[model samples]
Target chain A: MPIDLDEALKAIAHPVRRDMLSWLKDPQRHFPDQEHPLEIGVCAGQFDQRTGLSQSTVSAHLATLQRACLVTSRRVGQWNFFKRNQAAIDELVRRLGEEL
Target chain B: MPIDLDEALKAIAHPVRRDMLSWLKDPQRHFPDQEHPLEIGVCAGQFDQRTGLSQSTVSAHLATLQRACLVTSRRVGQWNFFKRNQAAIDELVRRLGEEL
Candidate 1:
């Protein structure tokens, strides 16, 4: 099924999620460097630090974004690296223009 | 003050709000005829009918949309006519492209 706009909007409604997007824009600047910054995005630990939120809260927020298709993640070792899903973001804008 | 993306996204997150946007796209088709269709958008009664929600609920949803700057309203007699805020919607898309 196609993603609902309401669900997607709700997922990104939190301030932390917005901050996550900003941080993802310049991962190296906002987060600690990993072994492969290019291959792996920011880890949940780094995201928790940047947002000053509890690790569980950050994890929950990341899960929300993942459900909304706003971000994609890759498992590297015991860490999950997350990067903004540019295609999904672009598609959201396109759909809003068409639907709204 | 500039609108926050998080706030706006939260406001439009409700299913009723999304339905409101869809209804506003074709007011006459979804809503009952009023005195001035062009001058005023759909009223609460018509909206309540289309959404099958309580009047108070529809009113609250409209208020949410208004807060998000996704829709604008004009008072007509005892009724408030709400229309989609195209400019604000466009600006939202633009900002998402720039910021997201």
Candidate 2:
């Protein structure tokens, strides 16, 4: 549990990642309309642009979120769509509330 | 707010730090009797023994927690006593729930 907590905390410890989570919370508002369905989630390019960072950097950040179970990703053709994992975040908050 | 979140998350991201929080949850059970009152909190030497870490290492970890406002410390003679700041932790968790 500590290891999982460590991973989740480290994944969320960064400013960019924290900002990304906030943006990802309401992708429809933060990002431009996509041709694909919104339910599929926001693509990496949108995050890349908003972050003002390299695509690789944004991708790495997304991967960290995925690893921490804070976000879920889905591949759509050449693009990967990412969305917040609300359940995981809620559970993390609950655990942290209890533990901390 | 992001900077505060960054500090709080980074302070708690380490396993040792997280373990310390759990132990501090109930200092009476986790630590031996203090020559002083328990209300003052656990001394650094007790943490040093439990962590199996050097006193300097334990102190550094405690300092990070204090900087993040997750823990409070008081100087008692030659020793610094430390304990969890429940209100700050609750506030951080609340903010994280809202932001994340």
Candidate 3:
């Protein structure tokens, strides 16, 4: 899917959302307690624990990032895993360089 | 002064503000019919005319961009000439590439 520049910009405006992206950049290092490998990305529960925020709050933030195409999420039975959408992020930076 | 990444991201989140930056990128092209040269950047009046927004509204938008360090303004007598802070913008893109 094509990245929505406006949405991406809005998504990263908040500190929590930005921190989420930063953490997801290196799941293995940030989320060491996860049983699943980094390939499936970090589970949502890990984010709740890492951020010390409520599950719903973390989920909402993740949803915002996912909406912006800054992150991608997958449902693994019960838990949802999320990883940085590096390509969309790269394109956003490139476009901002040229267009902004 | 250091660029505020969070502020810049917040500033550009709005479409009008983003369009303002895009317009200021090429002042001579985006804004014409001004008495002053490009050295002072585009006068705030031109923005009001181009955007068809009230002067106060335009000023508010410009203020938001200025606060973000995305754009800089100079008080040319009674009018404020605004221009893109290319260096800060470049730094922002570079940092986003690494940090975001």
What is the C-alpha RMSD, rounded to one decimal, of candidate 1? 2.4
Candidate 1 chain A: worst-modelled 10 consecutive residues by lDDT:
A30-39
Q: Which tens-of-lDDT digit does each residue in B1-100 have in candidate 1? A: 4666876788767767877887788776776565567547877788777778899998888898998888888997888888998777777777776766
Error of 1 at A34 (Å): 2.7
Model 3 DockQ class: medium
Q: Who is ahead in TM-score, 1 or 3?
A: 3
Per-residue alpha-carbon lDDT of model 3 for A1-100, expressed as tens digits?
A: 7788889998988889989999988887899888998898889999899999999999999999999989988998998989999999888888888778
Most lDDT-accurate candidate:
3
Colliding residue pairs in candidate 3 = none
1 against 2, candidate with superior TM-score:
2
DockQ of 1: 0.71
Better of 1 and 2 by DockQ: 2
- Cα error, candidate 1, residue B55 (Å): 1.7
Which residue pairs clash in candidate 2?
none
- Quote each prediction's TM-score: 0.85, 0.89, 0.92
> After superposition, which runs of candidate 3 have C-alpha atoms over 4 Å from their true positions?
none
Better of 2 and 3 by TM-score: 3
Candidate 3 lDDT over B31-94, as tens digits, reads 7788899888889999999999999999999999999888888997888999998888888888
- Share of real contacts kept by model 1? 0.90
Model 2 Cα lDDT, one tens digit per residue, B25-87: 898888865677778988988888898999899999999999998888999889899988888
